[model samples]
Target: MLARLSTDNRTAFMSGVRDYSPMLMAILSWGLVTGIAMSKSVLTVPQALGMSVLVYAGSSQLAVLPLMAAKLPIWTVLLTASMINVRFAIFSAGLAPHFSYLPFRRRLLLGYFNGDVVYLLFQKKAFATGYVPGKEAYFWGMALSAWAAWQVSSIAGILLASVFPDDWGLALAGTLALVPLIVSAVVGRSVLAAVSVAGLVALVAIDLPYRLALPLAVLAAIGAGSVVDVIADRADLRRIRTARPAAGTADPTGRTGRTGRADLGKES
Candidate 1:
């Protein structure tokens, strides 16, 4: 399938694969943990497999599993899942400018493949370059690699859940695997603020019913980040204004009034 792509696109695609390779272990660990959890839950093996294949969202699946096990109403489960996945809306918005020019079906497929790690990596690597050729190919490379790793590990976990002892602490391993990724993404003050706020909010609301804390943390983080961004923008605007010469007060030859008058006196 990749052979159909132009040489530049193929190169970009492979570069994406290489860049995303480092995260595959983390993805595998999380997928395995999620699959094991689903298997051990009230869901039957078929249901667990189905979810792993179809939903393809470990976080949303994990968030909604308990509700499902408790026989919650369908609407409640759907609502909780939607709220938990609300960040995807933001991710989609970030991605739209890059991929919106594609055919509708292609765009829909791309959305299905989008994930937290993929979005982050794409933003860091390709977003600044804007909507250029080979960007989509690069995205597909990372997306396909991640999807494959997840599905393979998840399926293995479902099949081998009984073989792996609970004492192995795989869940902790999975969580630890994500720490590096999170730390790497905290590159600026806004991201730092968002992360800190989200962590605090999640802890504070941990005991909320129906896993409400997750959505609360997400929203709080976005708000905090946005506030920080607005402040930074305003500060930048003020600095720019302060640096500019007052209108009609200075000569157009890059000279201030005092400097221009001094030059005039010297010329005289």
Candidate 2:
């Protein structure tokens, strides 16, 4: 059996919360909008609260709301929700390496808590310097903090939804919240390529039926990024493969081979 709670774990958990503090503003904003949307929709207060708790999926929830209100087909709603969340699949794959050492159950729980902002922050820190000790602690810290902030803000939004006016332009506020995160995540050429493609695709496909634009955009971005990642990975492998033999040949004498070593010795 594993020790689930330890001093290190507690410390890391708190640290994760602290590291994730700045991004909480964006998260809370989005959650607030999502909660307000849910409360204003056809769903009852209890139903909205239940969805907020059980689904905890702002994008999918929002995506399907208009469809639900318009009495669209059930299949359409389900499909749209699944497609909208396709990006989460990509996020999960990229995140797998960081927590591969953990057990399945623990990893699943962590995945549940690890949403977009936490994933981005963790990815930046982890990929930049490689994994250091206490990374797990940091990961959990960020995850829990994001989770808590989202739940609280959304619940607040839901409760106070009626008091809030529709013309408040909260959607724009939520979009503004994402600006920092979006800028921060675009760190490399590959990421820039992905973002460009996703944006272009989304704009072009904005009127696609069944609300397919979002998922298509996500797929486009993932495809672009994956290609870049593959090319980079292969290049790294080739470089390593070349360096290993060259290092072996050079040996301690700083010569490429036996003849070079002999020449150096003769010169000495």
Find the candidate with the highest lDDT and give its number: 1
Mark the regions of model 2 whose C-alpha exceeds 4 Å error after superposition: 1-7, 127-133, 228-260, 266-268
Model 1 over residues 1-268: C-alpha lDDT tens digits?
8788899999989988998999898899889989888999999999999999899998889888888989989998888778778888889988988877789999889989999999999998746545797888889899999999999999998988998887888767878887898899898889999999999999999988766898899899999999999999999999999998775477878788788888999999
lDDT of 2: 0.82
Q: What's model 2's lDDT at 39?
A: 90
Please give each candidate's TM-score. 0.89, 0.82
Q: lDDT tens string, model 2, 1-268?
A: 1167577767766777787888777788888889999999998889988988888878899989999999988999999888887777878888787777778998788777767778788877754333456777778788767778888988988899988888888778878877887888898878998999999999999999767898899889889988998898999999998876653377666667876867879999
Q: What would you estimate as the lDDT of candidate 1? A: 0.89
For model 2, give the 10-residue run with minimal summed lDDT.
125-134
Q: List per-prediction Cα lDDT, in the order shown.
A: 0.89, 0.82
Model 1 spans > 4 angstroms off: 126-130, 247-268
